[model samples]
Target: MLRYLRQIEVIGVENQKKLSNSSVLVIGAGGLGSAVITYLACAGVGKIGVSDGDLVEIHNLDRQFIHAGKIGIKKSKSAEMFIKTLNPEVEIEIYDDFGKDKSLRISKYDLVVCCVDTIEDRHKINEVCFKNKKPMIHAAISGFEGELAVFDFRNSGSPCYECIYPRNIHSEKNSVVSPIAGIVGSMQALEAIKLICNFETLNHLLRMDFRYMEFIKISISKRKDCPVCSKNL
Candidate 1:
């Protein structure tokens, strides 16, 4: 409680407790995962599950600060060690894989934060969260550009990840300016905190283009004939 005193002053003790009682799953351990995992732990999220199948590489050092010293370690384990040092009050679980079948476990948490880059994996996460009626925060970055959206499956009517980015659409190769990952990941953590505190966030697509230093929000809607979330309707 002492560590969270300043934050409690702004969000109130009730919201602080809410954060302390929530569980969130972060599915990535790279740039976006580093920031998301760090802030979520410091915010005192009660339980955090980190899943990643990659090992820390030399290149990952640019943005994945959580694995600063251990270059050969698994990302999930590295993140777990950082959380233990950063905030022992927060409990953590580590998963070494992010398979489509493994996505079912996402239902066990209050929220899921998608820090992965592949469209296929995003669709898999969206499917599981929608099926289990859990809200999710989605973030992606590429070349000083990033986008974020909240799929409030808890609402049952909000558009899903697939709704905004169709499966057939091919995304360009992943290329990111290191700082953009931090920017987008921090936004994901902030939005997750807001969600836990019962606050509303952008329901539409929020895009950031650092090259032009411009931000944009575009309204989005669920596809009535779509396959993913329409079944829930």
Candidate 2:
């Protein structure tokens, strides 16, 4: 309680307790995952499950600060070490290979944060979250551009990632201006905290172009033919 004294003043004791009791699964250990994991752990989230199979490379250090001095090791393990060092009171789980059974893994946590880099991975996460009726915080970054949205699958009408960007649409470029990842990733963490504390979260896609300092909030609607979420409706 003393550790979160300042935060408690803002969110109140009950909300702080909610954060302490909540569990979150962050499914990437790259740039976005770094910020998401760091903030959530610092905020005293009860349990954090980090699932990333990739190895930490020197290039990743530019954005994935949690993996600092941890090259040549799996990102999940590195993240676990960082969280333990930052806040041992917060429980940590490491998943080196989450591809085996996403549904089983996702079902164990209260909320899912999709920090993975690729569009394909996002769709897979979206499908599984919708199936489990779990809330998901999704964000993506490329160069100076980034976007974020929350799909509360617990609500039947919530629009999912697929509803906004269909499977046919693909993006493989990983180029990103480093600070952009930090900015957007921090927002994802805030959104996750808000969702856990039962506060209002972003219901629309927030697109930002840092190079131009422009932000756009686009309303999202469920696609009647959305293969992931609409079927459930």
Candidate 3:
């Protein structure tokens, strides 16, 4: 209680307990994964699963603060180390491969957070979440722009990731502004906590252009023929 005194003040003991009892899976261990994992663990989520098949590199230091000073170490292991250091009471599991083969297990988790950059991986996570009726929070950042969306597959008529990007959209190989990763990733963690605590979320696609100081919430709906989500419908 002492550790979460400030958070308890905002959400109260009951909601905090709800957060502590929930489980979440975060995919990717890059810039976005760094922020998402940090906040969720600190917020007292009971069980956290981190999956990333990358190693910390010298260049990743710009935004992957959780894996700092651990270059050459596997990112999933580094994230587990950081979480254990920040909140030992929070149980964590690490999976280096978070691909379609393992996505089927996502149903066991209360929520899945997509922090990876690739649209293919996001679609994979979305398919699993939709098939298993798990809620998912998705976010991505590129340069000074980022977007976030929450899809509660447990709810009827919710939009899935494929509904927004119906085609294979590849991100340009551009360097992202370091802070934008933190901003967007933190927002992903916030949305997950809100869902666990029964708080309201945008429940729409939120696009942010930090360079222009602009934020827009675009309304989205389920695509009746979405190859990924429609099958579940």
Q: Of the candidates shown, which would achieve the greatest TM-score relative to the real structure?
A: 2
Please report the candidate that would top lDDT against the real structure.
2
Model 1 misplaced stretches (Cα beyond 4 Å)? 99-104
lDDT of 2 by residue, 148-221 (tens): 99999899889899989998777577999998888999999999999999999999999999999999999999
Error of 3 at 196 (Å): 0.2
List TM-scores for all candidates, in order: 0.97, 0.98, 0.96
The TM-score of candidate 3 is 0.96
Lowest-scoring 10 consecutive residues by lDDT in candidate 1?
A: 99-108
- What tens-digit string does per-residue lDDT give for candidate 3 at 1-233? 78999999999999999988999999898999999999999999999999998999999999999998999999999999999999998999899888556656686689999988777778878888888889989998887899999999888688898989886565444379999999999999999999999999877899999999999999999889988777745
Q: What is the C-alpha local distance difference test score of each model?
A: 0.90, 0.93, 0.89
Evaluated at residue 158, the lDDT of candidate 2 is 94
- TM-score of candidate 1 versus the correct structure, residues matched by position: 0.97
How does candidate 3 score on lDDT? Answer: 0.89
Residues 1-233, candidate 1, lDDT per residue (tens digit)?
99999899999999999999999999998899999998999988999999998999999998999999999999899999999999999999989987556546786789999999788888988888888888889998998789999999888678998888788787665778888899899999999999999998878899999999999999989899779989646
- Shift in Å, residue 122, candidate 1: 0.5
